[model samples]
Target: MNGTSFDGLTVVTVLYRSAGMLAETLPTWVRSAGDLPVRFVFADNWPADGCADVVAAHLPADRYAHLPDDGNPGFAAGCNRAVETVGTSHVLLLNPDVWLPDDALARICAAAAEDPDTPIAVGLAMHGGEYVGIDLNPVSLFIDRPAAVARAPLGPSGGAAVLPTALYRRFGGFCEHLFAWGEDADLAFRLYAAGLRTRGLDLVLPHAGGHSVDGDDRLQGFRAFLLARNRLLVAARTFTWPLLLVAVPVLALAHVALAARRVRQGLLRPFLRGVGRGLVEGPGARRQWTGRRFGFGSLLRYLTVRRA
Candidate 1:
C-alpha cells in the first residue's frame, strides 16, 4: 500500500512460550529495523507462563501491542489475528527465535521497493552458521535443497518474510484451518496461482530453530500430529484430484515408511497417531483452490531442478 517502503511496517510475531528467546532476539530485531517507522504486534499462543511482561519490558508501550490470550490456537491463527489487529502498509511475519542483522530490514525494504507488485519479499534463514532451504517443492512436499540462485523461484520462507498488508488481507492471510504447519506452503501455492511472485532477498536472518518446544514430549507429539495432518491438508487443498490420486499415495507410503522407522526408534505411538489424524482430517480441512493451478512446466522444473 505504501509502494514497498518501510514507512508504515508492522512486524508480526507469534510467541509460543518463547520468553527467553524474546529477551535475546527482540533487541536485535529492533536494532535491525533501524529508523524505519515500524510497530510490533505480538500474539501469545497461551503460554503456561504469560509473556505480557516480557513483551512490555522489551518493547515500548507505544511501539508494540500484545493480543488477548486465546489458548494455543497455533501459528497461523496467531499471525492472522496479529495482522488484523495492526493497521500498517506492510507486515513482516517473523519467528521469535530469529535475530536479524543490522542491514536485514533495509535490504528487504529495498527489494520490495524494486518490485512493488510482488506480494512477498523473503529473507534467507540461517541456522548453525549455514543457510537453510525454505523453497517448497510441491511434487515432493519438501523443502527444496539449496541451489545457486539469486531469488526463490518457488516460495518464501514463512519464518522471515515481508508481505504487503493489502495483498495479505486480499488473499485472506494464512489458512487458519491449518492451525500450524504447512500453512506457509498453502499460502505460497495460492500466491503462485494468482500470478503473484515471492522475491527472495539477499539478507539472512539467524534463527535458533525449534527452541520453543524443544524438549517436551507432549508438545513434540502434538506438533508431529499437526505437521502430518497439515501436510495432507495442503496437498488436498492445492492439487487437482487427478494429481492427488497419484501424489497422495506416494506421500502416504513415504510417511508410512518414515513412521515405521520411527517406530523402531520407540516413537511409534505419536507417529502413528499423527498419520492416522492426517488421514482422517486432511479431507475435511479447508480447500483453497481458486481455479488457478500450477502449470505443467513449473511442475517439470520443480521435479528436475533444485533452487538456492
Candidate 2:
C-alpha cells in the first residue's frame, strides 16, 4: 500500500463555498492520495470564495486538476462535469467537508484494486460528533413516520461513494436535472434496480456535515420539496411495475406527512409544486432510462439483506 503502485482511482469532489474546510481537510487528503499515487479532480463551483487559493496553498497546481467554473452549477452538475474528464477505472465522489484518515485512501484504493468491479462502496461518516452509518434507503417510509422502513442494505454515505466508471457510464451517472438533492439516492436505487449491490465499509470518513450549506434554514423548505419530489422520481424510474405499485402509495403517504410539516414553514407551495413536477416528469424518466431491463427480484435481494 505504501508503494505508489496503486493506480486508476480518481478522487472527485465538488467545492461550493468550502475554502475554510478545504484548508483543514486538504492536507490529509493530499497525503493519503499521494501515498497511493491517486488522481484528484476538484470541481470548484464557487471560485470567488478562495477555493482555488486553498488548493494552490496545499497541493501543487499540476498535481491535481482544479477545474474552476464560475457558473455555480448545482452540486450534481459540478460532479458530473468533473467526472466527464476522468480516465480512471473508478471514481470516488468525495465531499469537501470530509477528511480521510492517513491510510484511508490507500486502503480504499486497495479494495478497488483487488476487485476492479466493486459496484458501489461507501464509508461511514461523523455526524453529531459520532460515527453514523450512511442513511442508506431506497425510498422507505412508514408510520415510524417518514423514516426508512428498512436499513438492511446500508450505504452510499453522504460523505462519499466509490463506484466503477464503466457502470457509472452505463447508468448515465447522476441525473444532472436533479440539480442537487437525491442524486445519491437516485443513483443508488438505479444501481439496485440493475442488480448491483452497495457495499458498506467500516472505514470512517470524518465529515463535519453541513459545511457546504452550513445547515441553512432557508434551505429547509427547499430540501423538503426535494425530499418529496425525488422519492417519486426515484421510485418511478427504478421500480418495476409490481414494485412501483407497492412503493407509490407509501411514497404518497410520506409526501402527505412532508406537506403537513412544510405548511408550518410556509413551504407547502414548493412542496406541492415538487410533487406535481415529479408526477409530470416521472414517466419521461422511466421511458428515457428503459434501455436496461432488470427483474423485481433484484430490489428485494438488494434491500432485504445487509451487505457489509
Candidate 3:
C-alpha cells in the first residue's frame, strides 16, 4: 500500500466519560493528521461530559465532526457508528485515553499501504513511554497445548489500531453485544479469522493504562467474569471442533484454580460467583461468526507484517 492509494483514511474515537483525556488526545491527533486527508469522528457515549465540544475546539471544522451523542453503546458498537458515518476507505479506531505522537498516523498509513489487501495495522501501545505488546489470546484448548498458545500473545490491551473500511464491512466489524470488556481481543481474533492479520508496531502509542477501575486494581472479579465468558464465546464461534473440545474444559479448570487464588487473596465470594456466572452465561452468549473466511495463508501473511 502506498501513500496516494491509501490517502483517504478517516479516524474515529469512542469516548465514554473521558472529557479530560480527550482534551489532550484530540490536539495530538490533529497535529499528526496534518495534510493526510484524514477526518476525525467522535461518538460520545452517555454521561459524555461535553467531550465532543472539547474535541471541536481543537480540530478544524472541515476535518472534524461531532456526531449526536448516543447512549452507552459498547466500544465496538460506538466505533461502528462512527465508521458508518464516515466515507473513508480506512478507519482508525483510537481509544480516548491514548495519545499518539505527531508522526504516528502518517507512519501507520505508510506501513499499511505496503500491503494491497487493505491490511489492518495496529500500533504498539505504551504506558508512560514503554513498548507494549498487542496480546492475542489463543483458543482455550490451546492452553495445555503450550506450543499453540505460544504462537500468539495474550493482552492486557486496547490502545490504537487502524482498520480498512472494506475489511470492517467484510468482517461485520466488532460484536456489539460484548458490552465493554474483552471486545478488542474478540475483534482482533475475528480479524485473524476473517483473513485479516493484526500486528503490534515496534513504535509505542503513549496511553494512560487500564480503564476498568484503578491503576493496579485489575477489576479482578469483573474481568475474570468477562474473560471467562467472552473467551469461551469467541472460541465456539471461531475455532475448529477439535480445538474447541480440548480448549474448553482445560480453560475452565484453570479458571477454577485462578479463582481459588483470588479467593485466598481476599475475594473468595466474588471470584467464585464470577466463575459460576461465566460458566452459565458464557456458552449462552454464543456469537455466530458468518463473516469472511481467512485461512492459514492469511495468518502467515499477518505474521510477516511484524517483520515489516
Candidate 3 clash pair list: 1-113, 1-114, 1-115, 136-153, 140-247, 141-247, 195-294
Ranking 1 against 3 by TM-score, winner:
1
Candidate 1 similarity to native, TM-score = 0.87
Question: Which residue segments of model 1 deviate by more than 4 Å?
Answer: 1-7, 47-50, 124-133, 137-140, 144-153, 286-291, 295-298, 301-308
Give the winner by TM-score. 1
TM-score of 3: 0.78
Better model by TM-score, 2 or 3?
2
Question: lDDT by residue for model 3 over 265-297, one digit each (tens)?
Answer: 666666566556656755555446655333445
State in Å the error of residue 189, model 3: 2.7
Question: In the order shown, what is each candidate's alpha-carbon RMSD?
Answer: 3.0, 4.4, 5.0
Off by over 4 Å in 3: 1-5, 68-70, 116-118, 127-158, 215-224, 264-274, 281-284, 291-308
* Model 2 poorest 10 in a row by lDDT: 141-150
Q: Output the worst ten-in-a-row residue range by lDDT, candidate 3.
A: 141-150
Q: Write the per-residue lDDT of candidate 2 for residues 210-285, one digit (tens) a residue.
A: 6765567666666667766776776677667887787778777877777777788788987898899899889887
Estimate TM-scores for all models.
0.87, 0.85, 0.78
Put the candidates in TM-score order, highest first. Answer: 1, 2, 3
Ranking by lDDT: 1, 2, 3
lDDT of each: 0.71, 0.69, 0.61
